[model samples]
Target: MTIEPRQLPAAQRTLPAMLQRQAAEFGQRPLLRVAGRSWSHADAAAAAAIRAGALAQCGVTRGDRVALMSGNRIEFVEAFLGAGWLGAVAVPVNTASMGPQLEYFLANSEARLLVIEADLLQRLHTADLARTALQTIWVIGEATGSWQPPEGIRLVPWPAGAEAIAPAAVQPGDPLAILYTSGTTGPAKGVVCPHAQYFWWGVNSAEVLGVGADDVLCTTLPLFHINALNTFSQAALTGAEVVFESRFSASGFWPSMRASGATVVYLLGAMVPILLAQPEGPGEREHRVRTGLGPGVPAAAGQAFFARTGVRLLEGYGSTETNFAIATAPDSPRGGVMGWLRPGFQARVADADDAELPAGEAGELLLRADEPYAFASGYFNMPEKTVEAWRNLWFHTGDRVLREADGAFRFVDRIKDAIRRRGENISSFEVEQVLLSHPAVAACAVYPVGSELAEDEVMAALVARDGSVIEPAELMRFCESRLPYFAVPRYVDLLDDLPRTENGKVQKYKLRERGVSAATWDRGPGAPRAKG
Candidate 1:
C-alpha cells in the first residue's frame, strides 16, 4: 500500500521513529538482506540501538558527523542507522572514492569518526588524516597488509555494543545525512538531507511504483547513493523486504534477482541498456520483477528492456539534493518525457533571470516543495552555494528541460559541467584538477561526449608541456589510481591549444562541437572516429 505522508505523525518522519514504529507494526517481517545476513523488522530497531550504543562508546554524540566508507554490507546499514538513531549525521563516502576524494569528504563534513571496510584501509595511505577532524577509525574485518594508522589517530577492530541505548530525541527537520554531490566548477558539495526529506522520498517513490507489503525490492546499486539508501526507507514504510546485491553484474543480475525473489527492482538508465546488450536467455523472463525505476534511460532502450525482460522501466527525475519530486506511473500518457510534477512539489522552467518560461520553451528546471523539509536543507557548509541554488525561493536544478504544453517535462541536457557516466556523477572540475597535476600536461579541459549507450563518456583535450610528450596510455594509468574507474577519461585529444573566448577562458562549447577527430586517441573499440 502507498504511504500517505499527510497521515504520518511529525515524529514518525525521523529514522529512529520509523524504525521503532515499523518494529511494532511488522515484527518479524523481513526488512533487509545483504551479504548473506538478514534483518527482520524487529531486528531493525535492535540493531540500530546496539550500533548507537557502540557509537556513543566512541564519543560520538548528537549532531556529530560519522563517515562510513564501505560497499553493500550489513555493517554499512548498522553505522548509518546508528548515527541517525543518535541524532548524528551520517556521511556515506562513495566506496570508489580515492584518497584525495576521501580526505575532502571527511574534511568538508568535519566527520569525527569513520567506519571503513578493512580492505579499503590502504586508501588512507594517500589521505592526510591530520587535516581532518577524525580521531577514531573502526575497521570492519581484519586489516591486512602493511598499512598503519598515523599518530594521534586511533585504529581498532569494529567495537561491540556496550549497552542498548535509547533513541535520541531527533526532530523531522534535523539533518540525517550529508551526501556529497560533484560540483561543476569547484569541489564536491555535501548536501544536507533532513530526515523528513527521506520520509517523503519513500512515500512518493512507493506511490509511483505502487509498492505494497509482502513485495520484495532488490537493488544492485551501492549503499552510498540516495538510490540505494532510499530502498531501506521504502521497505520500512511499507513493511516490504529489500535485498542489496554487492555490485552490478550484467550476467548475474537476473540470476541474483531470481535468487532474492525480488518483485520490484531498481536500476539506473545505463543499466537497462547494458542488460539488454547481454545474450537473451530464459533468465530474463524467469524472474518475478514486475517494474523498476530507470531514471535517465533513453525511451528506445527502456522499451527494448521491457519487451525483452518483461519488466516495465519507469522514467523519473530526481537528484541527491531533492526528494522524488517527479515520476511516471504505469498509466502515464507518454513514454519519452519525465512524468508530470509530483504532489507537494512545484516545478518551473525558468530562464537565467528566474522568470518562468512559456510552455514548449526550454530552460532551467526549478523546483520547490510545499511540504516542510521535503527538500535538502542546503549544501552543507556552503552558504554562498546554498544561496545561489536556493535563490528566488526555488532550487535551481542546473538541468535544461522543456515543459511541454501537456505538462510533461522533457530532458534537454545538463547546464553544468558535471558529467553523468554509468549512474555516477563525474565532476569535470575534479577530473581537470587531477589532469593538471600531471607534469606532462601544461593545460587541459575535461568534458562529456555523447555515448552510444545514451550517457556521457569522459574525454580530455590537453596541451603538453613544451619539453614533454603526452602519452594516452601513461595518462590513463595515472588517472586510474587517482580517479574512480568511471571518472577516468576514455578518449584523449592532443591539442595545440583549447579554443578560447576574448577573455581567454576555455571555450568548452567549441571543444564539444569539435568532438572526436582523427588525431584523437580512443582507449576502447567502437568509438566513432571522425573523417580526416
Candidate 2:
C-alpha cells in the first residue's frame, strides 16, 4: 500500500510534533536501527522525550546551540532529536573536520555544549577553546587514560535518560539545525534549516522514492550530512524502517543490505563507480534493494550499475540551502540531466547579472520555493553572504547549467571555486589558507581537477618562499592535521610564480585549464611511494 499525501498543519511540521504523529500512526513498527540497536516508532518519540529532558537538566533552553560531532550512531540521532524537542538549534559538524574547521564551527555558532565521540577528543587539543563559547563536552565513549579536558570546560560522560519531558512548543518557522556548506571564496556558511523545511524533505523524498510502510531504508552516508539525516524523516512520515551502518564499505555494502533486508538504499555519484569497480559477484544482485537515490552518478556508470546489479539508481538535485527541488522519476524521459524541477519550487537559468537566460542557454541556476519556510531561512551569522546568495528574491545556486527545451536541467559546471570529492564539498579557500601557513610556501592557488570518477579532485599550485625549498610530500603531511583528508590536494605543482591578472588576483581558471602536468607530484592510491 502507498502512503497517502496530506498537508500537515504548521504546528505538525516541527520534529516534536512529527514524532508524536508518527508514533501514534505507526505504533510499534520499527522506525530506526543503528549498530544492532533498534527503536520502534513509539520508542523514537519516547527516546526524544527523555533525551530532551536530559538536555534541559544540563541548562539547555530554547534557542541554545548544541553542537554534535559524531558518526552514524544512535547517540547522534538522540542529540539531534533532543535539540529540536528542546527548541534548541542543532549544529551537526562533519566528522572529517579537523582542528581548524572544528574551531570555526564552534566559534561561529557560539555553541554552548558539544556532544562528540571519544576518539575525536584529541582534535580538540589543537582548537582554542578560549575563542569559543563551549562550556561543556559530553563524550559518547570512554576517553584515553591520559586525556584531559581543557581548562574552564566541563567534561562528562554520555548523558543518561532523565525524566521524560513534554515536547517544546516550537513553531514551524523555528530553526531546527544549522548545517554548514563549504564556501567557494571564503569560509563555510551555516545554512539555517527550519522545522518546516525538514518536514518537506521527508514528504518530497518519500514521494520520489515511493517509500511505503513495508519498505526498509538503509543508508551508509554519514549522519552529519543532510542526505542521511533526511532518511530518518522519510521513515517517520512514510511508516518505513531505516537502517544506518557505521560507515560505507564497498566490500561489505551488499552483505549489509542482504542482512538488513533493505528495500531502499542511498548512494552518492562517486560510490556507484567504486561499487562497480569491485570484481563482479552474485553478491551485487543478492540483495532485495530495488532502487536508490544516486544524485551524481554518471549516465554511463548508472546504466552499467543497473545492468549488473538490477538496482536502478535515480538521479536528483538538492543542496544544503534548498530542499529536494529537482528529481528524475523511474520513467524520466531522458538521462544525463539533473531532472525536472519538483513542485513547490521554481527554477531559472540566469546570466551573471541575474537576468534569465532562454531555453538551451548555459547559465547559473536560480531557485525559489513557493511553500512557506520550505527553503533555508538564511546563512547563520553571515548576513552579507545570505543577502548575496538570496538576492533578486531567488537563491543563486552558483552552479552553471543549461535548461533544455523539454524543461530538463543539464549539469554544466560550477561557477564557484569549490571541489566535491568523495561526496564532500571542499572549499579551495580553506585549503589555500592552510598552505599559506607553511613557512616554505609564499603563494598558493587551489582548484579542482577532473578525476577518473565523475567528480572533482583537489589540486594545488604553489610558489616557494625565497631561499626556502618546498617539499610536496612534506606539505601534504602538514595538511593532514590541518584539513580534512578529502580536502588535501592530491596533485601539487611547484611554480616560480602563478598566473595572475593586472590587479594581482590569481587567475585560477588559467591554472585549472593547465590541469595536471608532468611536473606535478602524484599520490597514487595505496601506493608505497609518491610519484612525480
Candidate 3:
C-alpha cells in the first residue's frame, strides 16, 4: 500500500492559521478529551478564538506576554492557542513551583496578564505584582472561595464567548512562547521559541514518526513543556486525536492508554522505571500502543521495557530550544541510542574550546538547523546569553555526548551541573541556594550521583556553621519546606570543609568521583544509616 503523508495548507503555515485550518477540516472530529467530555475541533478552535478576542479587548495586544498557570485541563489548551491567536507569547508557568520560585517566574517573564486556574489564583494574592507591571488576571474553572483578584487586576471568567478575532500577521521568526528550561543552571533560562520553529517541529516530528489520522496520541507530559507542545502537536497536523492527562500516574498509565486506544505516547526516562516497578501482569502487554518517545532509557531498561510492554521505544534527543535534533528510526542499528540527525539538522561534538571533536570522541553537543525554521530565534531579553549560546553560529546544548561511526549519538553525560532525577532537571545552583538559606548550612555543594532507579539522584555535601549542630534529617525537612520535593537532596554528607580549588570553587567532580553509597553517607550525628 502506498502511503502519502498529509500536507498542511499553505495559508496555515503559522500556529493560529494551522489551528484554524484544523478546526475547519476536522470540525466534527475529536480534538480534545478531558475529564469525561470530548470537544470537537470546531468547538475547541471557536472557544479559543473567542477567548483570544476577549483578551485583545482587555488590552492584551500583539507581542504582549501572558502567563498561563493551570493544570492539565481543557482551559490550558484554550488559553494557550487563544494567546497564540492574538500574536501574544504564552508563558506556561510550572504549577509545581511555589512561593519565591513562582513569584520570580511571573515577575521575570514580565507578563501583562495572567490566566490561572482557580486553585492557583490565591497565590497571586501573596505576590507583590505592584512592584512589577502586571495589569490583569483571569480565572479558569470556578473561583476559589478564598480567592479574590488584587487591586487593578481584572477577573475574566474562562469559556466566556466573544466575537471571533483575527490574529496579527506574524513573521515566522516572531516569538511564539517563552519556555523556562527546568532549572538546570542557576535559574531557568527562558528559551524563546518562534512560531515557525514550533510549526517546523510539528511537521518534522510528524514526518519522523509517521503519525496519521488513524493514530491516537496520549501525552502525560505537561503542556507547558516543549515535549508536548512540539511532539504532541504533530497529532493535530496529521488529523489524529490527542488524549491528554493532567498529570502522570503509573497505575493509570496502561489502563488510560488502552481506554483511549492510543497508538502513540510520549515517555520520560523516569516514567519507564516507574512503570517497570509496577506489579508484573498480563495487562502490561495488552495495549495497542505502537511507539514511545523521549530520552534517558538505559539500554538494559529500554530492552526490558519493550520486551515487557510490547511497545516500540523510540528515543530522541532535543531541548526546548531545538526540537527533535536526533531521533531513532524504527529499525536503527543501535538499540537504545538516539539515531542520526534528522533532515536539515546538523550535530557536532565539540571540546571545551568549541572546536569539533572526532566522531568517536566525547564532547559537548552543538546543533545547527540547515532550515530557517528549525532553530530558536534567541533567548528572551538576554542578548549576551543568546549570543553566547549560539557562538560560532551553532546552538550549544551544554550536554556532553559522543557521536558514533554511523552518525548516531550516544549519551555521555551533561557538562553542566544539573541533576535530572525523575525526568525533572534540578539545578544544583538552585538547590544550593535553598540549602544556604538554612542557618546551619555554612557551605554546601550540590551535584548529581548515579542511581539505580532514576536517571540521577541529588547529593549534597555541606559544612556546618562553626559550633553549630545540624542533623541530616533536620536539613532535609528544611529543604522540603522551602523547595520542591524533587530538589531536596536525597543524600547529605556533613563535612568540616568541602574539597575546593585554589580559587574557592568547590570541586564537584571529586564528589562525583567518590560517589554516594550507603556505606559513605552519614545519616546524622546519632541516627543509623539506611542501606540502599
**TM-scores for all candidates?**
0.97, 0.98, 0.92
Q: What's model 2's TM-score?
A: 0.98
- Give the lowest summed-lDDT range of ten residues in model 1: 523-532
Higher-TM-score candidate among 2 and 3? Answer: 2
lDDT of each: 0.91, 0.91, 0.77
Clashing pairs in 2: none
lDDT of 2 by residue, 301-346 (tens): 9999999999988888899899999999999987788999998899
Question: lDDT of candidate 3 vs native?
Answer: 0.77
lDDT of 2: 0.91
Error of 1 at 167 (Å): 0.7
What are the per-residue Cα lDDT tens digits for candidate 1 across 9-35? 777899998999899889999999999
Predicted candidate 1, C-alpha RMSD: 3.4
What candidate 1 gets wrong by more than 4 Å, as runs, is 1-6, 525-532
What's the number of clashes in each of the models? 1, 0, 0
Candidate 2 RMSD to the real structure:
2.4
